[model samples]
Structure formats: C-alpha cells, structure tokens
Target: MAFSETVKHEIMVKSARHCCVCHRSKGLNIEVHHITPKGQGGDDSADNAIALCFDHHADAGHYFAGHPKGSKLSPAELKKHKESWFSLVSQHKIENPKIASVEISIMNKDYPGFFSPVFIRETTIYTDRNSMRKMFEFMGKNPDSYVEEFKARFPQNDIYGKHKMSKIKTYDDLMEYFNGDMEKEDREKPNTDPQPHKFELSPFMREYKVINKSNCVLYLKLTNGDKDVLEDYKLYLNFENVIEADSVTKRSKFFDDYKYSYNVFFPENNRGEFIPARPVLVQNDSVTLDAICFRPDPKAKFVNLNWELFARGVFGSGTIRINIKSSFEQHIRERHVEPSEIKPKFIRILPKWNFE
Candidate 1:
C-alpha cells in the first residue's frame, strides 16, 4: 500500500480511539470528515480532518455544510477524524490509491469575509452548576429592577434557564432567602441540589395572533404579582418555522424549544406604513395586537407563511397562514388573528407581496 506515511500513522492511532461527540467506544464503520470543507479554502492536510463514528461523520458533514466556525478545528481532533477515514479505507484492502481523484464535496457557499471566527472572551462566572441553580432561583422572584442590578454586577453570569437551573421555586422566594442574613454557621443557608423544579412556570406571557390569510404577531407581557410589565422585546422571523406542520422548514432547524410565540406584529398592515414593530406592555394586561396585515403579491395565486417565538426565558406558541386570492382581486379583505394559549417569542406578520 503506497499510502502517505503521515496519513498511515494517523490512521493507526485513531482507529484505536473513541468517538469525539459521544465519547463512546469507536468500533468499526467509523468515518472521517474535514471540519472545514476543502472547497472553502481548506487544505487537505491532517490538521483539518477528524474521525467520527458513522453517525457523527454524517452530522459533521451536515454541520460543515454551513458551519460558521470552519477554521477553528483543532489539529488533534482533525487528526482523529482523518485517521478514522483512512482506517476504514485501509481495512477494505484497497490497493495504493491516487489522491487527486478524491473530489471532496464542499457545501455552504458564503462570499469572502462573510463570516469570521467567534472570539469567546472568557470571564469567571458561575462555573459550578450548583451555584448556577442558586443564581437562577435568586433571579426568579426578585423584582425586574433588582434582577437588572444583579445582571450589571454579574454580567457574565446568567441567573435563569440559560444556566440550566430549574430548581428555583420562585425568583422572589430565592431572593428572600439569599438576602436574609443567616450566619455562615446558620444551618439554613440554601439547598445545593440538582433536583429540578416540579412545575416550572414563566411569569411572562407571550401572546400572538395567526391570521388565516395574514401573518402572525407576538406579544411579550410579564406578570409581576397583579401588575404586568413589558420587558425589552423584539420580533424575530426564523427561516424555519417551529410552530406547525404547515411551516416551510422542519422543526429540527429551529434552535429554540421552550419558545412560546414565534413572531409578533402590531397596528395592522392596512395603514401601508412601517410601524416600529416594537410594542409597549400595558400594565396588568398581556400585549395583544389590534390587527394584522398581509402583503399581497399582485402576480401570485397564494402565499404560505408560518412563525417562531423568541423570549428571555420560555416562548409562547406559533402558527401558519395560507393566503389565497386571485390576481384580479384588488384591495383584498384584511386577514390574520391571534393564536390561543401558546405565547410565541418574536412575532411578525410577513408580507407575501403578491398572490400566485
């Protein structure tokens, strides 16, 4: 076998190793991958390869298709992936092979300078999971103003689900305990356990409307005792709608799971002007849209649309809309309505511009 001596050595080592993602034992059928696609200026050197179990290899291929952090694959990890690939090929007893024929497929095309590496400047926060839970339990019951103060003091630390802490019974209840001066010798400091909260509830209610022939709108309203306040809110329209089967994209594409509402719009589109789209929460009430508008494509017959939700904590609900109209129809009837129960995150009533 006339394999590159360097490649041969790498294969020998990784074939005896374990899979990276799952850390499971690497049995046969493992595959190799180039973390950065060769088509996107990646060299075919061992520094860019990685050995993955068959499933991980497929996942790596999919992630590499448009992976933003293409240049950051570590040399060691790359070597492992390469070794796995070579080991498989060698086991098949394939004779000496030509390298140039290896037309590595490259997906995800972005223009030059479109994406750069992500620089994660690290700071000391709640590295301990126990402390993280205590922090969220502390944040849950505190007033919004107090939470903001805590955030400013500990900007790097998250006090909520971002840290995976769900044991907190109440943000205020936690705050009461934390603020109480129990001496270091006090027996009732706080319970440091990972037991998840039995019934985790979000104080905020994200509301939205899904019109049959119109786009959806979102409302993020926070409940504080008897008063309702709107926190800093914005609407986000995802390429993949996670709400219903009618979505153009699949659920796996959606990154957020706990999200309630998908998109939120306000003031209706009939006015023919761009509303700022941000809504102010009315005290003691949930943010609701007055009306929703649709952009009718004059040349199209119909339009399909769906929504996703984004929130600080839990999301609301989502929905889809199919607007049908004829080209000859002018001044189409206004359509779109709010969804029930599920409050989505970012909500927007999209415009199709024309009917098919």
Candidate 2:
C-alpha cells in the first residue's frame, strides 16, 4: 500500500510486457503469481512476483526434470525464480532491438590495417520516430563528429556479442543488400566499379625508395591490376589531412611479378592475418596445441616485369596502379578473391624477400 506511483506503473509495465518464457502477450489476462508463497517469508513486492499465464504458471512447477509433482515451492524458491525470470526478460528485450558497434584499425601494408573491434551491449531507446530522425539528421550534418560520437559511445569492449548479426560473405553482396533500402535517385546513379574503402591506401599510395640526392624518407607504391575491378583502386588515406608530399626518383628492379599488392614492408607487429581464407596448418603436433599457418599465396606472380617502377608512377607521390586483370579471372586463379571484386587478403612484405 505504501508503493509510490512510479513503482506501481513500472510493475504494471512488467505485467504488460510479454511473458518471458511462452512469448504470449500478458495484456489484461496476466495473473501476478507470488514466486514466494505468503505462508513463506516472501515480501509483497514486485520483485517477488511475476506475470504469467494460468497454464504457464502451472507448467513451471512441473516442467523441469528435477521438479517434483504437486511439490509446492517455498517463499525463498519463488523469489529466486522471479529474479531469474526478470533476467530472462531483460536479455530478450535487449537482443530484439536495433544495435550498433564500431571498429578501429591502424593502416598497414600486408594487412588491411590495425583496428579494434567494439560491440553494442544493449538496445538504445529512441522514444519515437521523431527522436530517431533527429539523431540521424544530426549524424548527417558532420560525418566526422558523428563518427567520433559513435566511437565514444560504443567504446572498446563497451558491448559484448550477445546476439549474432547477418554475416556478409562478400563486399559486393553486402552493398547490393544495402542498395535495396536506398532512394530511387541514389540507386539511379550508375554503380561505378567498387571504390577503395576510405581507409585503404588507394588514393594515398605509400611509396618506398632510396633517394640518393637526399636520402631522408621511405615508403612503398601500390598498383592496380589490368582488370575492371582495378578501376575501383582509388582509396582514401588514413594519414588525415596531408596537403602535399615529395617523390623519390630512385627505383628498384625487384617488382617484376605477375601480381601487385599493397605490402607493409616493415610490419612492426602482427595484428593477426588479413582476410585469411581459412588457415591451412603448416605444422601440427598431437601433444601440443600449437601450429604454423600456411595461408593462400594469392600474391604469387605469373609474369615478370622491369623493376624500375613498382607498377606505375614515381615513388613517394601517391599513385593508383591499373593492371586491368578481370575479377573473374582473379577468382578462377584463386578462390580467396572469388567472393568479392576486391578481396582484402594478406601479403608478406619484407625488403629482402623480393617477388621477382
């Protein structure tokens, strides 16, 4: 009788919520069952009671394997059961709503880049469509700010994998799936070839060469193959706003290979393998749980070329390589690249191990 109005409303909401186990709406027919019997010491509070259908309430006492027939539970047992029911309801509600997460990575050569993966823990309440629209509109005003806000809210390990998302097997498939939800005007534009993701080194190709006149800096050059998909090689560099840079004239003759890739010549650390197409065991021991990885050699070359230019353009300056290799052909050559026009695969880039 001393319960506050807010507490009473919350208890009403709990009753109105669908039943935790049977998926049936509580509505007006739900009965508040005292988890702990009055004869027992169970408190007359919302936590000690749960809304359940008549049939479910009866079945609960008999369904479990260890539950006794006609064996009534004590007040303490009922209270414990009610608490368990609340936890179940919370988990179900959280997973059924929209959720978002963020991932961050460091740009690397052999790998796509070093990034941290973050997940969303619970469902965010938007109250109404207007509230959601306002947030989306706010996000549209400044993408960078929106991205920052997103990263901040969904910080590293902020959420855990409580539910699974629809997995995207390939990039193209993922885009086409999203295209279904776009406006008519947005979809009308000719779908240009896949563009390098903003974080990729397509636009800002890192070039590496020994400058004799003033040997100061070092970098590597990235090239596109002679293929339709190669046209999508234009990428955004993660280095931020780099207004301009200098190019090194010196060239090496070691780049004569059938294929070309963005290689991180000196990968400081292994942030795991990039786009590994299933790990082939190089070595296995029955006694020990350690093994070596033998990933696909997709970067293996078929033809050799002059080493003057890695693929095209001068070193140091940003450049896009265009070798024009058909995506289909690339797929036939290797299944690893089959799923997508641009399969993010890993490569070994040690200065000493020249592809030539």
- Separately for all candidates shown, the number of backbone clashes (residues 3 or more apart, or on different chains) is 59, 24
Q: For residues 330-354, what per-residue lDDT tens digits would candidate 1 score against the true structure?
A: 2222111112422333323223222
**Cα misplacement distance, residue 204 of candidate 1 (Å):** 50
TM-score of each: 0.21, 0.20
What digit string (tens of lDDT, one per residue) describes model 2 on residues 186-209?
Answer: 333421111111122224575333
Q: Could you give the C-alpha RMSD of every candidate to the true structure, in order shown?
A: 26.4, 29.7
- What stretches of model 1 exceed 4 Å from their correct place? 1-71, 74-230, 237-284, 288-293, 298-301, 329-356
**What is candidate 1's TM-score against the reference?**
0.21
Model 2 residue 313 lDDT score = 14
Superposed by TM-score, candidate 1 places the C-alpha of residue 190 at a distance from the truth, in angstroms, of 69
